[model samples]
Target: MPPRERDTARTRRTVLDAAARTVAKQGAGVSLDVIAREAGVSKSGLLHHFRSRDQLLLALAQDQVDTFAAEVRAAVDPADHAAGRLVRAYVKAIFDSLGDDTAISEHLLLSAALSTVPGVAEILQRDARQWEAAFTSDGLHPDRVLIITKAADGASLATLYEGGSNPAALERTRELLLSMTRGEGSFTG
Candidate 1:
């Protein structure tokens, strides 16, 4: 890319990273001035990139969803059954995020706060619907797919909130969920 474009991208990334950390630490009500200070950019510079507070929040929310989707895609294996691949990818993504110390996961955990901003919730909701449709369209029964997905989500939430290692339980739950996807076990919920 051109130098000017590269610098612009770099600046944007720095600002976004700072914004995520500030919001995660300070909640969604944090001021743009604080974010600019954190990013080491002038408030005018921050505004030049994001235009407005709502715009910045929307960008942050979209970035979170995009990052999550990329993680899931990386974890997925094309040879696996579609349903199994989706569930495994999601579970793996959650675990991977939990293990990361870069604060991206913390930023994502602020989705509830982001949702309060005008367009952020819609972005998240759209991603959820897209994932739901993907799972439902897989050959597996929709109810089973949903149950497995919900279970994984619950496990992820528990791990995120509790903040500790319970490798045995997590492994067992992963195995059980994978087994269900493979048609090797029955689960009702």
Candidate 2:
């Protein structure tokens, strides 16, 4: 790659990392100027890549979603039962992602974007449908199963971000989701 392209890539990383840290520390109200300063770059440099705050927020969410998707694909055996593999892989990936501090930032950003931006929720809904379809081949009721999955994920995320120090909690949640997916236990309260 050319030096200019490499430099641009580095700058983008710096901006993204700084944005993550800023949001992690200061919540979703963090300004681009603060992010630029935290990244050791000028505000213009940051804006060059993002163009606008909405663009930056969307990019951040995309990065996190892509990361989770990649991890799920890597962890599960697709040749196995597709539904079972997707459920197991998703559970494991959610747990694994919780350990990364930057994930909190990603979560907050994603939440803010979906709540404040029109049509962003549609993107999430579409992804959820895709996830449900991926797990449907196991004879599971995709809608019900996905509801349980999202509930479990929401609970795990709450614990993961609240500074609660317990690996057992994550493990237990993972096992619970696995059991539900395996038809070994009821997911309902």
Candidate 3:
């Protein structure tokens, strides 16, 4: 890429990183001025890329989803068990997300918005369904596996973000989730 284009891209990335840090530290009350300072960019330059704070937050959410999908897709094993692959990918993502302030901030904002915004979860849910269908095609019951996996993921993400390394709790939850997914017993809500 040309120098100017590269510079612009770098600036945008810096601003996004800064915004993610600010949001993670201060929640949604974070200010654009703080983000600009964190990025070491002038307010004018930051505004040139993201016209408004809402736009910046939206971009952060989109980037988090895109990065997550890419990571899971890359981690999935094509030849081995798909259900196991899904669980591994999900567990890895949830625990690993502890180190990612961007994803943390993005999820906090996106989940809140999902309650108020109709289409917020539509695309992500569709993508999740498609992935679950792939597992079902391998002979596992999609609905049962998806429910357990989603619950496991939720619990893992919550623990990780809360900085609570409850390994025993996580291990028991994982075992239960795997057992239910494997249809080993009569599991219920």
TM-scores of the candidates in the order shown? 0.85, 0.75, 0.68
lDDT of model 1 at position 151: 82
Residue by residue across 49-159, what tens digits does model 2's lDDT show?
Answer: 999776776676566566667888887866666446677777777777666545654565546644555545666677667766677765666655776568656854564
Most accurate candidate by lDDT? 1
lDDT of 3 by residue, 63-130 (tens): 65777778766765677563456655554556555444456555666455532433446656766677
Error of 1 at 71 (Å): 0.8
Candidate 2 lDDT (Cα, 0 to 1)? 0.70
Model 3: lDDT equals 0.67
Overall lDDT per candidate, in order of appearance: 0.78, 0.70, 0.67
Q: Where in model 1 is the C-alpha error above 4 Å?
A: 81-83, 100-105, 159-163
Q: Which 10 residues in a row give candidate 2 its minimum summed lDDT?
A: 110-119
Task: Kindly indicate the candidate among 1 and 2 with the higher TM-score.
Answer: 1
